[model samples]
Target chain A: QVRNELALANAQELINKINEKCFSKCITKPGNKLDSSEQTCVAKCMDRYMEAWNIVSRAYISRVQRESQGESL
Target chain B: KELGKFLESENARMRLQQSIHTFTDLCWDKCINKISNKIDRGEETCLTNCVERFLDTSLFIVKRLEETRKKL
Candidate 1:
């Protein structure tokens, strides 16, 4: 139960970030309604943002591994 | 007993995930310029390097603070 909540919270944070970044990139101006092109742009932006997040995670994890190894040796 | 171990690991994972969220928020702003069909190779490299450098900066600050404390 507690584990599930933690996972949910983590996912929620990711969703909030996606909303913030995708909105800023895709919506140049506030409009009454979201048009199709804006929707498309948001989709692409979200995908790229996720990719960027993965890249960052990989880089950080690898650096941590390297530093820990250096310290142990 | 088992539950305690599980919770400890969960907490550790949560902390790691939290840091990733912060790094992504900051580095995305620095590396991403325009929304395109795909993330280019240059942008990808920039994002990776951004994370590495941010951690380096963090370590540098801590080390500097410790040295200053020792001197004082």
Candidate 2:
């Protein structure tokens, strides 16, 4: 239970960082409020970000696998 | 409060998601040319390639630097 709680806390910290970075990228200028178009952009940006993350994670994992295989040979 | 612990856990998940989100945005900008509602086949490939190549590049650079140091 303590371990799970610790993991959750760590994950939350990561989210805050991502939000700051993504928001800056998606929102060029801060308007009075988030307009519909801006909101749409943010939504799309979030999805794209997730896709990119998966791709990178997969790539990294595969590269690690390949390196390990090479070492075994 | 119990809610405090729940909030903390939720925050952690958000953080992990956000890290991935940033990485995707950075790589997508570098590798993707066209932006649409869904990632097309070509763009998807580009993204994967980009990630692999980026990692390779980092590793290569590090190795090269180490070799240079050894030669010194």
Chain A TM-scores for all candidates read 0.91, 0.76
Cα lDDT tens digits for candidate 2, A20-54: 65577667889899889878876776666556666
lDDT of each: 0.92, 0.69
Question: What is the CA-based DockQ of model 1?
Answer: 0.81
Candidate 2 lDDT at B52 equals 68
| Distance from true location, Cα of B31 in model 1, Å | 0.4
Best model per TM-score = 1
Identify the CAPRI category of the predicted complex in candidate 2: acceptable
Q: Which sections of candidate 2 miss by over 4 Å?
A: A1-10, B1-25, B32-35
* Chain A of candidate 2 compared with the true chain A, TM-score: 0.76
Distance (Å) between predicted and true CA of A58, model 2?
1.3
- TM match of model 1 to true structure: 0.93
- Name the weakest run of 10 consecutive residues (lDDT summed) in model 2 chain A: A9-18
Candidate 1 deviant stretches above 4 angstroms:
none
User: By lDDT, who's the top model here?
Assistant: 1
Q: Which ten residues in a row have the lowest lDDT in candidate 1 chain B?
A: B31-40
